[model samples]
Structures are given as structure tokens and as C-alpha cells.
Target: MSILKLKPSCKDYLWGGSRLIKEYGKEYEGEVLAETWELSCHPDGPSVIRNGAYAGKTLPEYISGEGRQVLGTHCRRFRDFPILTKFIDARDNLSIQVHPDNRYALKNEGQYGKTEMWYVMDAGKDAFLYYGFQREITKEEFAQRIREDTLLEVLNAVPVQKGDVLFIESGTIHAIGKDILIAEIQQNSNVTYRVYDYGRVGKDGKKRDLHIEKALAVTNRIPIVRKNSSYPHAADCDYFTVDKLNLDGRVMQKLSGKVSEESFASILILDGEGTISDEREELAYHKGDSFFLSAGSGTYTIEGSCDALVTTIREKAAQVRIGIDIGGADTRIGLVDVHQKLIAWKTVRTNAMRPAKEVIQEIGQTALSLLEEQGIAMEQCVGAGIGVPGTVDRKNGVVRYSNNIKWEDVDIAKEMGACLPIPIYIANDADCAALGEAAAGAGRGCEDVILFTLGTGVGGGVILDGSIYEGSGISGSELGHMVIVENGEPCTCGRRGCLEAYVSVPALIREALAAAGKELTPEEIFAAAKEDPVVKEVVDTYIRRLGTGIVNAVNIFRPRLVILGGRISEQGDVLIKPLEEQLRQGCFGGEKSGIPEIRTAVLGSHAGMIGAASLI
Candidate 1:
């Protein structure tokens, strides 16, 4: 029922033809109409609504007036409209160009990089387009070839025909061939770095500028591996998924589909003469027609012969993932929803003295009870992620060892699977906590982070590119085992002067007891440090030694954030401020690479459970 016809914004680039204006029936007064932005909300060239109550309003304006719910829940991930669809008519070759990836583009251009797919509608004889490089080329050779005006020599040119499809990822150097009419579906971005323009001049009678420097930085000089279209989909990528729809008036005169609440549907009429009807109303359609159907628009049907492309945002449902944080005293089970919120939780006594299988069975039963109370079925849950307080062989879902709960060589997944009918994943408790913090805690929005938990022992985890970075052998993230001193103090891990030996809660208490002649809790020691010189020295020394370990981590990973967790981290700024100062002075880059932000973990006890669930 909620369908709106779109009026395209025409472009008159020098390389464009008049096909869009003549054959496609686009109304443009320009000498040549090269491109038509069909379904766009981009500020550069927005499509206008031609029918319905929002007539005469640009797509962006309509979206603003109607609220983002019209875009559907799946679009919640995007800051703006997710895609830009266009019809490109190239009478001459487009400039050879490359698009930066999201990281680089956001830093340099303040926009997402373009990853586009082109569906060829028509092509002239011998039509060919430059893809990536024909072979791997060095940066020196690429620059030399560009300067010598021979870059095309090393480029991979592919012959094109009607119905041919090409997916161009960011950093791929490419150019559209002459005499090709194509439909392009791309990310909502207009940033481009043109490398070669074939001596073309703009309308101002001046040579168009070339972005050779940026092109040199982002271009991928390797041959691109082409892939065939998978059945039922013409092109599929993170940004968009497109499927071709064809209806022959005699054999297949009708087509029907339903747009669900997850995503909106875009119907781009290429060669079609049909009537499209939804639950509320029906409208006639022809070639070059574009329609935007809001999410949950029930069923839609098209009748008469047609050739069209259907595009939809195919994002996974944001379902809950069960997280179980196994501890020595208690097992905390929680349901972390799509927003990484601990929507529901329960705690049960963990009788570690009992057999591992018995303990796991209790934990599993507790999780099932929690789900039942919340009205969540096993099918609705993404899966279960368990955080074991020990070495975990994640590949095999085995708790290799756990000194906290005295678990050894336990098949956690198999035991838990007996009660929960879903996939089970396991990881070191610290690693799980770090993953949780990275996703929704202190390191939220950061892809790389390092978390150090200063608890009974200084446990830590490395999260690189948003995943727990457990290196080869699965014992690699034992951060506390790294030695910072030769023989200063003995560690529980039987190592001398390991980071844990110097800065753990017990170590801090030991230092306080040695200096103050009395045992003090971490909180009391921090409070007494304000007036007591001896206690201040103990705390400063603790900070200094911990800073050494932190500096070592920052130097190695250069993560975007360093998170301090565990109970001792409750010191907040008192701990982070001094450590940050030490890290600024002692880190490898000496502040030139920019210091990673240091912060205390905010998730409290739920970090482990939420992080465990994130494993799914």
C-alpha cells in the first residue's frame, strides 16, 4: 500500500549519451543526459517523489518527514540511506578511478567508500570496461604507468554484453566502457578519486583535476578474481543484494512478493509494461519506472511482460544471544539482546567442588529456565556463548583448564548442548569479557582494543578487528604471563616478575602490607594513599609497574583503546590518569601515532556474560 513513484535527477556529464532522455523518457533539457539517479537519498543528487501525498518532495525530505521507521528496522545500522541506485549511459569512457575503503574514506572524506555493482542493460559492439589490474603490479610500476599515460596497458579489460554483471569493491581501479547503458547500485556515497581522465575537459573549458595521489594510496594493484552470479541473486554484498525479475506475458505473466518488516524493497523497472498492486492500491508501470515500497507493505504483484531488478537490504535479525559467565562462586546467565543490553539475567550457585558435568548441567538448566521465563524459545536465540575461567580451546569448544573452578579438559559445549538446543561457543573468561567490552562497553565503536583485568591475577585479552585475538595454539592471550622484570616478584604462574606478580590485587595488597605494616583492601589502600606517603609510594609503584605492562601492550597492538577491568579498576580516573600519562611517555610511537584512549570498564559483572553471548 505504501508505494511511491520516483522522479530521477538527470546528469549531463560530457561522456554521457541522450539515451536516458530519449529512450528512457527522462525529461531533461540538457544537450545530453548521461545518468539518472533513480532511487537515491544522497545529498549530491536526490530523487524526487512523483506521486502520492509526498509529491514534489525529495527522497531525503520525505524520509525526514515520515521518520526513519519507513526505512525499516534493518536500516537502523546506517546513519543515512543505505543505497543509491542509478542509470548510467556512457557514450565515452568514464575516468579510471578508485574508491577508498570505509576506514580511509571516513578519515579523509567523511563519507563511506563506494562498492558498486553494474548490471549492463545494453552495449555497443566490442564494448569493454576496465576492471582491476590484469596482473599484480608494484606501486612504482603503477605510478610510472600512470605518469606515462599508459595505465590502461596493465588494466584488465572485460568484454560486456546485455545482462552482464560486475561487482567493484572499494580500492578496485576501474572505468566504464563506451556505449554502455547500465544500472548501478552502490553505497550512499559520492566520494571518488579519479586517476586517469583521458585528457578530458570539463564544461568550463579546463582540464578536469586528477586525484593521482589519493589513487596511488588506495588503489589495489592486484588482479581481481571474478565470480559467477549465484542462483536467485544477481549481485550480493554487505551494502545491497539484487535479484533479477523477469515475466513473459505468455508464460509468466505475473510475479508476486512480500516486503517484510526487516527491509524496504526497491523495484527498478528496466523494460516493463505492467501494473503493480499492493494491498491498498495498484498503479501502472513502464520502462525506467522506479518504485519505493515501505517495509511491511504486505504482498505486491506485477502483471504483463517485464524485465526488472529487485533490490533489498538483507540484514540478519537482531535476535538475543544467551551468555553464560561461569565463575568460582556463582554462574551468571543472561540474555543479551540485539543492542548488547542485558535484558534479563539470573544467578545460581556454582558448586565448583562438584563434578564438571554436574556443574555444567545446572548452568544449562538455569539458562533454559531464564529463557522460558522471558518467553524466548531456543529457536529465537542466536546461540549460547560461555565464558570459562581458564584456558579454552575455542576451536574444539573445550575448557582446557580452569584454576578458578577446578575444571580441566571439560567438554562444555557437549554438556551444555544436552539442555539447550542451540550452538554453544566457549572462550577464556577474560577474552569473553574483553569481547563484551569491545562490543558494548568501554571500547564500543572501536575495532581494536586491549583489556587488562587486575583481579586475583592480572588477566587480559586482545581484541583485534572486533574479535578475540587468540593467536596460534589458543594459549596466546595469556597477557599476565608476560614478564616485566627479571626476578623482582614471584607470580602464581610460577614466573618471576611477570606483570601479574607486580600489579594484581593480591600483589598490591602485599606491597601495602609490606609498607604500611597492616593488610589493607584495594579501596582502603587507594583512600589512604591520599595522605599516607608510604601507601602512596605503594600505589605509585603499582601504577608504574602496571603502566610498564600497558605500555608493552599498546606498543605491540597499537589498539584504539586500552580498557582496565576487574574489581581494582573501580579506582576509575585515579588509575587511568597516571597510567595514561606513563603510556604517553613510554609507548613506542611517543604520541605521534596517537595514544589509545584508556578507560575503566563500565559493564561490571555483566561484561563477561554479554561478551560470552557475543561469541555467537
Candidate 2:
């Protein structure tokens, strides 16, 4: 695929605290309003439309398949093909605001709400960003503070630095400080509820409307903040995997094999200039350029000058286990007795392939039948839980994108509930596994836990204080999509050098095949690690990369534990010992520091199924 160049789209606002120009004339004030690029949805922001006869149309029209053939897939799925990338130059502090997820939006605004991230381009000395409340404040307290105009006292302000990336999950009260530039990536939704804006006036000399009720409704009491951090550099999951490569001078990066049984990838050039080459083509890239590569593209190479950061997003490996009769054909439902002591199970069913109406009907019938056989009635089911393999508006149960299932904008929960009459909870499967591990598996009893699944690809789940943390729209836990290696391997998510591209099952297989000049299953390669020095070397390299990736997670999350699951976890000691050692040696925290404990997942194969079921 050819590279797509995204143009700069800016916003000029007379926001009370803007960075406009100085006075130019007696009647005109050259004050700099907040100059912004609206990458996603912001009611007051600009939208990016495809160039052509319908060029002036909004992004929603393009995503809804109004005209262009190239955008039909995007419109149907509502995937995160970031439309309007922006450069925000804040002159004064913005408002302290939070966004609702799709669920909140459906319940109130009747649309999907935006969830965004900011990459700091520049900041003044002592400049800070508003993140969460200073401490855990109750909903009532937060409401009262906003009502009393004392909310500023409770906000947590973090010092800012250039190159710092902040992941603002939905519902976290945050704002940008003065003299800063940021690149924002978000959901294609335009609903924001401001709790406070420093009591500033607009160009019209009026305060903006405050959505106190709505803001309080969605604001998270316990907001997490990680400072002075970079990308994960390596991680995985079904949706996307990321790797952060800090390159200086020249570097050679290669990616081969597969991350999942089936998947694709993309590359995002965050900095510097570089070229990616495959057997068929060579492409040059500069800062902010992105490209997509098919999963079937096999091995490839990237050689670049100066320093470049690349991120690869791809599919996670399929989890496996033996089992007897469970249920459903598409569900991949099965139960296997383990060691006559344990039972492992998995279920991978989706309605993405069928018509939306049919998918809803099929899921409803199957769920009802499954529940009834288990002596549980539909009414007693509490809520139906689903694990999608792609980007999802979890709050509203909308499957935004799923290449594996070929689904887009399907309200699986709402539609199914219409027929089944039950509350429904949905999330990414990897996130489900993370929550499962936290609730009843290896991370049991821990307040904070980060679960990593090593399979064909990698997936992550974050649990805090016994509750799964779903960001705005329930689209938060995308650990695998963090960039690690600059201009490294290609990923499925249309980025390059993501974690999945490096240490995933397919990546390991690729390395092994490259060394032995023959293809081998991940299992066969592991078995050979004991006898073949070459295989051991390859396995060691993977463990080292995996360890570095874990270090990144540790630095960012500071969890109480890091649990590993999925098929690759079957390698056991071969993967764990080295991983633990490397993490200990390479991480930022010293021994006895608040660094998290790293362990193998005890839930094994049933993790996903149990996690999926627990989502209820």
C-alpha cells in the first residue's frame, strides 16, 4: 500500500485562555486563540473529509460510505483511521473536562463520546497538565466542589516535558496548560462535558456552559497518572501491539513470521526520516507518516537515518487448550481436562460475519440456549458479556472495527438485548483476560495488576482496585499498540515496530525459520530450545525483547503484579526465567522498589472464557 500524507487542520478559538496573536490595530486584538487540530470528534472542532467533489463533507459522511470507495470500509466500521490530526498550541489553561463512553453517550447525548491521547510537542518551564483529582474524591464531593466553584483545589497537576505522551482515558478530568503543543488521537465522537475552565471568559466575554451533572456522572474518582515515560516498545493483543524504538544515527530493523493465526499490520513514523523495504517495494517516510502492510507480507526490513520511532499494530495469537463438548461451532467452545486436576476452556464466537440483524438473532438464540442448559435463565443472567477481537466502543457495546470478523458499527449489545432483554457488557477479549486474571486468577486480591497474554500476538489487561479499567468508550487497554522499536517490523494496525511484530509467536517462528532455513511451529521451536543452541539463541532473543517490553509496562503502570498467559506462556520456564531476570535488570525501579511482581498466569487456557463470562 502507498503512504497517505495527512494535512494539518487547525482551529482558531477565542477560548478564555488561548494563545492567539497580539494587538494589531485599535479595533483588532491579535491575541492567539487556542490553535488546534481536531484529529477526532470535538463538537467545536474541525473534521477531515476526503478530497474530491464531496471534499467539503464532514468525516462522518465519509465514514458512513457516502461517496468514496476507499473510505467505505472505514465508514462501516468506524475504525480509528485518525481523520483530522491536529497541532494544539495552548496559551492559557483549558478547562478541566471528562468525556463519556458510548454507553454514557447513549444514555445522555445519544451519540458516541470521544476518548483522546496527547503527545506533547512542546511546553514552557513549569508548565503542567491537569489529569485527575488530587486524591480519590467521592462523586458527591466532586459534584459539590464543581457546584461551589472549588474544583480546582482537587485537581492533580503534573509537570510537563517535551516528548511526553499522556494517555487520557475517558472520564478522567484533564486539561492542557499554557505554551504547549500536542498531537491528539481520539474516537470519532464529539461530545465533551466540561466541569471547569478556570472561570475564564470567551471572546464574546461569556463563560462556556458547564456540564456539571454529566461530567460528574462519568468522571473516574481514582485517576491513574504515569509521568516521565515513553512507549511500551513491545506488547501484544488481538487488536494492536506497539513498540517504542529510540533510534539515533542508523539502525536496521527486521520483522518476519506471524503475530496471530491471521492478522495485518501498519507503521507510524513518529520521528526522523527512514525507508522501509520489502522484496517487492521500498518506501521512504518522514515524521508523522504511516503505512499499512498485510499480515501475509511475510518478513521485511527497515533501514533509517537519524532517530525514528515506529509502532506496529497487529493481531494477537490464538489461545489454545483441549476440551470436550462446550457449545457452538463459531464460538470455538470447548472444555479440556488438565492433569485430572484442572479444566481449561475457551469460547470465540462473534456475529461480525453475518448481517447485523442476523448476527443479533444468532447470538441471542445461542446465548439463551447455552444459559438454559447451564440451569441459568435469561433473566437471571444479570448481563450478557461479549469479547470482541477489534476496536470497540465498549461503553455502548459497539464493535467499531474487527477485520477478523469483518464487522463495523454493530451495536451487538443493544440489538441483542432487544431480543434477550438483559443488561450486556462487552470488551476486547485481551482486556477480558486481564480483568479475569485480576478477579479470580493470578492477580487475585491485588489492587493493581497488568496481565500480558503471549500468543500468536500479545494482549494486555489492566485492573485497579478489583475493577477493570475501561477508558472512555471502554477502548483503553491498548498496551500492545504502544510503539517500541523505531522503523522495525510492520504491524497489522497500519503502524510499524509494534511489540507484536517483535516477540509474538509468529515473530519467534519467523526468527527460528530464518535461522534454520525451515518453518517450525512455535511448539516445535520451544521443544528444540533444550537441544539446539540455535533455537535456544532465538528463544533467548525473544525473551530479552519480551523483558524490555515488560519493563515499559512496569514503568507506566506500577502494578502489583504482571501475569503472563496465552499459548506462548506454555513455553513456561524457557520464557519466564529470562524474562523476569531481564525485567529486573533493565527496569527503572531498583530492587525493593514499588516495581510489580512478574509471574506466569495460573488461569492458563480458560482465562479468556472465564474472563469473558466474568465481564457480566
Candidate 3:
């Protein structure tokens, strides 16, 4: 395919200026041209393909027809189209607003959260915009200021000029001042929580409604340290990376770049006119032109006497993170790319008899072997996330002790780092599973969730605000040890009637066998319950005990959801259906508070591996 030129969709927002139409040559008959979506696949305003056999189709249609692989491997990380580009001409000050990060946005808005960067094209003298807070304020103080119409007093307003760059992370409070034209690159989400709209009435003659509560919940109420961010790129974020390209039509007549299969190239013309061509074909380019060159389109040459922003998703290998789940019996290692896809993996036995040094050495060697087998270079890896079954001193990347693997005071990160030149981060294995579930599995969009791994022993992780919250900065969240009964059955941790004693797979198996006067695996126990009354009682009691623990967790954390993982959870609806009933009846607030959505984890054993890889 040749270079795909895009015809932008126009927006006539209330705060729009006509600069886009008059100065930028955007053809729109409306009285005000607020923004031009030069590169977008959003249903609200998709860019139309302007040239080629698919000229009449919208960008989404083209992607649908050409297949998603045309977007390249890096884009696969996103659930939908990864980017949206726009030219905004702010005639009036935008509302003081904030945006939710990915977890919050996906749950509430059904889209990715917006993290945007702005490259100033033009700005009138004395123009200024709010960046964040001038100083940290209490939640009560913030609320009081907003209610008193004094919120702007605490906001940090900075003057702007042409060529200034500002990266607006999703939760940062910001507003664009009047008389400024900007080129914006952002995630595809369009959720904006307007905090303070300057009491301006819209064209409909009504004050814009304020999402003060949601804004307060998501806003970062601290002063942001401003920087130009010269990090070897124009802008860099989890979602996108951008570079500035300029040509004078004088000394530099042509610029060249290679479009590898790992990522496609998106070029937006800011000024001047020139032609962009490759091995496939050549196309004319001018200001306002947006071009999409498919990945692996090799040896692209831009004979452009123009200024442009060249954006591309970094290659998949470059972002691949390794997740290593160290189990007593066997260890699972997975290579997850930028999109959290486990593209390559390996399984090796845990040589528990070996010294800690040798075990760590093997883990590192196996990782390199997997990379070699998959044809990935070490330079392509971001780093590794290791999930060990133990208490860890995360501050120093030390494994204080692991009962499962019988290791103590091991600097696993250093051992692995020696074998592999990349950074090695270690965390509790159960925590890794929770993070994996939250990142890409059943818990993907939820912000706060509890993952119960119902394995040999019921270990789990607590994810709050997209992070593992370890209380007191060291030891806490030993969810399995929470006692549900007094002086009942002894637990592996020497506690009587703890949640793990009643709910873990081993405990269930022992009790089921004793009840039925016969042996059975968890799978067989569930199978026997259907026809045997004794086994049926065992299943019922197991569900009730597990429900007790779920109720306790829900009431304490009030998380949006709960995920059941590890071995016993794979029984599917057989175990979950009854547990849900128990939770419905046991939760404190009844129907008003609503029980969290409880679901079996989809990632299974790989959760530890994938979660570990994503820690970076």
C-alpha cells in the first residue's frame, strides 16, 4: 500500500477559533472551526482516507479492511486504536478540567484514559494556561475553594510561547488559554471531567455542568515540576512517542527513515509542502496532511520541504517485559510485549535442592534462551518482573524469605541482573498474579480489586489504586492468614480456622476425602458432589467458608471487584455460583452497596508470568 493521506474531520466546539480555517487552510463552512482531527479512529470523529483505492473510507474502515496487523505490533497493546491527533485553535480559555487514568476511564467511560502532549504552534503574547496546582491543598480545602469560586487562585498558570511543549498526564489539572493554536497527540479516549468552567454559559444559554466530585477524586492536588522533556524524543509516554521533524527546502532537501514491521509511521505536516515516498509509491504532501505508512514499508524517503511531527509506536520487542513465576515444582517464564500479550514463553523445573545462586543463574539463563528461541535481542527487552513465593524487601530487591522455595535473604534481582544486563524487579508471586489480572485479564479496567489465588495455600494480593499496597512499607496484606473461625482446624501458618485453612485446595482436598471416606482431587470432588450426598456437603461447606472470607474482604476494602484465581477457581460456575449467592446474602450494605463482580481469572497460571513481565 502507498502512503495513506487523511482528510480530517472538523469540530466546531463552543470555544473554537477560526484560526484553523483561516490560517491553517482547513475548509469548513461553519462560523467557527475549533479543531481538526487530523488523525483519528474514534467513532465521534474519524478521519477520512483522502487518497488511494480506499480513498472514500474512514480511517477505521481502512483498518478494518486492511486487517489490524497493518497498525503494527506496538499498537496491539491497546484494546482499540492507540492514538488521536488534533489541531486545536483555542479562541477562548478551555474549562479547568482533569482526566481519569486508564483504569478509571475504562471502567467508567468504556475507553482508554487520555494522556496528551501539546506542541505550541502559535500563541498570542500574554497567553497563559493552568498546568496543575501552585501548591498542595487538602481535599477539604480544594472543595472549599471550588465551592467559593476561588479554585483558580491555587492553580499554577504559566505563560506560553510558540514551540513550547507540555505533557499533560491524565490526572493533571489543566486548561488551554485563549489565542493559542496547538498540535495534540493523545490516547483515543475522550473523557474530560470539567472541574471549573469559569461560569461561562454555553451557546445553549446554560452553565456547563461541573463534575466536581469525579474531578476531585482523580485530580493531583500538588504542584507539577515543569520540564521541556528532552529525553531523546519530542514526547514519551506509555501510550505514544513523538519526534519533531523540520525541513527548510534549502540545505536539507530529503529526509529518510525505515518503517520496520514492529511499528508503523504517522507523519503530520505542520508547515511547508513536499512529497513522501517509499518502495511502494510516492505521494504529494502539504500542510494539514496526515499520512499513515504501514510497518515494514522499508526505506521511506520524505522529499518534504516542511515541518512535521513524526510519530510511531516503538517496536514490540523494545517493550517486551518478562514475567517469571517461580514455583516450588516448576517455574513459568513468559515474554509479554508492549500490549501485554505473552508472545513467547518457557517452563522449567525448580531445582529446589540447588543453592539459591544456581537457581537464580538458571532462571536468568532460561530467560535468555527463550529470547534467543524467539529471535528477540536483549536490547529489545525493557526488563524482567520476577514473582517469587515469599516476603520480599522490595526496597532493596531482596527476598527475605520464601517458604515455598525455601530461600532466605537472597538478592534475586542482583543475581538475575548479573546474568541479564537489564533491570530485574522482584515482588511477591501472589502480588504478581493480582497485577497481571488487573493489567490484562478479568480485572483489566477496574482500579481497586482483590485477587485470591486458591492454590495449595490460599495466597492473594491486594491492588489499590493500580498498585500493590503493602502496609507499613514492609509487611502486610497476608490475606490468607485472616482468621474466619476460632480454634477450628490448624492452618499451615499455625493459625486455627484461618481463611487459608478452609479455602485452600489442599485443605479442601483433605476435608473432602475425610468426609467421603475416600480420596479425590478437587476436580473429582466437584464431579462427585453431583451424585454423592457426602461430597455435596463438602462442596457446600467449602463455598460457605470461602464466602465468609469474600464478605470480610469486600467490607474492608470496598473494591470495585474481586477475582478468584489459582487451582480451585478453574471449576468454573460450579464453585462461583454458590459463592456469589453467599456474598449476596452476607455483604453489609445489602442491595444498596452492591456486591463486587466476582469472576474466575482468565489468565490462570500465566498470570504470574505476564504480571511479572509488566511490572516495569
Candidate 1: C-alpha RMSD after superposition: 20.6
- All candidates' lDDT scores? 0.88, 0.61, 0.85
lDDT of 1: 0.88
Number of the top candidate by TM-score?
A: 1
Stretches of candidate 2 off by over 4 Å are 1-329, 332-352, 472-474
Model 2 whole-model lDDT (C-alpha atoms): 0.61
- Which structure is stronger by lDDT: 2 or 3? 3
Instruction: Please give, for residues 499-604, the per-residue lDDT of candidate 3 as tens digits.
Output: 9999998898999979988888999999999999999999999989888998898899888889999889999888788878888898889779978889999998
Residue 354, candidate 2: alpha-carbon lDDT: 61
Best by lDDT: 1
Cα error, residue 59 of model 2, in Å, equals 36
lDDT of 3 at 368: 76
- lDDT per residue for candidate 1 within 520-542, as digits (tens), equals 99999999999999999999999
Candidate 3: clashing pairs of residues: 77-339, 322-613, 323-613
| Least accurate 10 contiguous residues by lDDT in model 3 | 103-112
What does each candidate score in C-alpha RMSD? Answer: 20.6, 22.2, 20.5
